[model samples]
Target: MKLSSADIARYVASDISDGSYVNLGIGMPMLVSDYIPEEREFILHTENGMLGMGPAAAEGEEDWDIVNAGKQAVSILQGGSYFHHADSFAMIRGGHIDISILGAYEVAANGDIANWLIPGPRPPAVGGAMDLVAGAKQVWVMLSSHVSKNGEPKVVESCALPLTGVGCVNRIYSDLAIIDITADGPLVTAMMEGLKREDLQAKTGAILNFVPKCEILKSFKNEA
Candidate 1:
């Protein structure tokens, strides 16, 4: 079975190094805050002008003024503070963030990402992704599925949608696997349980290489 969105978020959270400054993009990327290990301390940043961001607030405990870039009510850590939008973008553009976790519509094997727009009725919105991709030391994408709803692969030889940032993504955390974008191409570092290397390759558009000891990803729901 494929991993759930929450499972993927937990796995992504587990992979983040301790003491890193991380910026979580809106949507599924925001869920990662809920699964970070208690022992690890991360400085979460929001483009809408908040730092030391915490997880989603409990129902009825929300502080309307405290929200993430997604505009969802969120909790703020003890040392958290707010600033102007200019200062937030300044922090982002200054390369203070270590990793940026973003959601995407398609990611190319070469590390290009296209997430802001799809070929539909909605107006295109780039948001802060362009700045994050250019500023963050590393960019990791979070996707709910490896394939589009019509069975088209999201990981491909090249992104079909308009590019957000070229050759910017460093890794991809999808429901099916964790892939690193390398000069050689997309490399599989971990895969969902019940899938084989060949099975993954069949669903991917670009060629996939795997490490000798690719780890099998399991649900973290049962972990202590």
Candidate 2:
């Protein structure tokens, strides 16, 4: 359906439940906050040790001390709280977070995730990804379908990077499509406008099984 990155972001935002505690991972996952309805209350947690994080502050409002997992400066809401790093991780490892939005390099059909590490001289950091993938009740991965800037497939049969976790992802929001990792396989729940199922599959390295008569959201249509 030729969805853009913004479409993927909107898809993830729409799935967030009111008042749910969510942890946004680095990279594309961080963009979900901008799409979330301001009126809807969602508590954001950062592993670097802040909770109840607000959206990116305006110019001159940056707080050097407060930041998200990405280490980017952030703002705190009125009811926000701060804690030690150990305690913050305890909250994550103890399963206090309702949902986690993460960026992925590859997602297996069994829901395995591998976004933290890539081979070579300068590998990507693992950071708090392992904890988030393991602890969150639902792990939503946001990524593009292709692997390279040249447009190779990233939805692989198996991840080439060091895995963050095995069978941790519950849902995936990608540029070209939205999918859910079910017991059966990767189900193509939605495709972007003008994109056909075959077209999406052709670009995907992994096998896909679409649910019969799944409702596909082509555009922003209010919170669902």
Candidate 3:
């Protein structure tokens, strides 16, 4: 079976190094906060002007004034602080972020990402994606689906939508596999248990190179 969102989040959280200043994009990327290792320390950054954010607020304990960029209620760690929006972006653009885990609509094998704008007429909200990709020390993508709802591959040879950042992605954690964007190309470092290489390739739009030892992913829970 393919990994669920929680499983993927756990994998991503475990891969995060200790003492890193990280940013979590909205949507599935937000789920990562619930799974970060208890022993590890991470200072979560929110684009809406929050630093050192904690997990989601419990039921009826939410303070609407304190929310993430996605407007979801969240708790602030002991030393967490709120600042001006400009200062929050300054932290991103000034290269202070260690990693930014973002959700992607499409990720090219070359590491280009397109998540902000589709082909629709709705006004686009690029948000902080461009800044995060350009300024973060590493950019990791979280893909909730290997393919779109319409059955199109989300990992493609090239993105069809407008580029978010050119050759900026460093890694990808998907429901099916963990891929690294290397100089050679997108390398499959791990795959879901019981999934065949051919099966994964069929769901992807790009040619994939596998590492010598591709590990199998198992279901995981939030230990926090």
Best by lDDT: 3
User: What TM-score would each prediction reach against the true structure?
Assistant: 0.94, 0.91, 0.94
lDDT of 3 by residue, 46-95 (tens): 98988899888999999999898889898899888889988998999998
* Model 2 misplaced stretches (Cα beyond 4 Å): 219-224
Off by over 4 Å in 3: 221-224
Between the candidate structures 2 and 3, which one is better when assessed by lDDT?
Answer: 3
Model 1 deviation from the true structure expressed as Cα RMSD, one decimal place: 1.6
Residue 71, model 2: Cα distance from true site in angstroms: 2.2
Worst 10 residues of 1 by lDDT: 116-125
Off by over 4 Å in 1: 221-224
Q: Specify the poorest-scoring 10-residue window by lDDT in model 2.
A: 214-223
Clashes of each: 0, 2, 0
Q: What is candidate 2's lDDT per residue for 1-224, written digit by digit as tens?
A: 34566667777887898999999887777878888876788899988888899887677988777777777778898888999989999989998999988888788888899887778799566788899999888999888554557777778777777899999999988777778999988889877777778888888888999978656657554436
What ranking of all candidate models by lDDT puts the best one first?
Answer: 3, 1, 2
- Give the range where candidate 3 is weakest over 10 consecutive residues by summed lDDT: 215-224
* Model 1 lDDT per residue over 1-224, tens place: 88889999999999999999899988888889888899998899999989899888899999989998889899889888899989998888898889999998899999999987777888777789899998899999998999999999999999889888999999999889999999999999999888999999999989999999989998766767
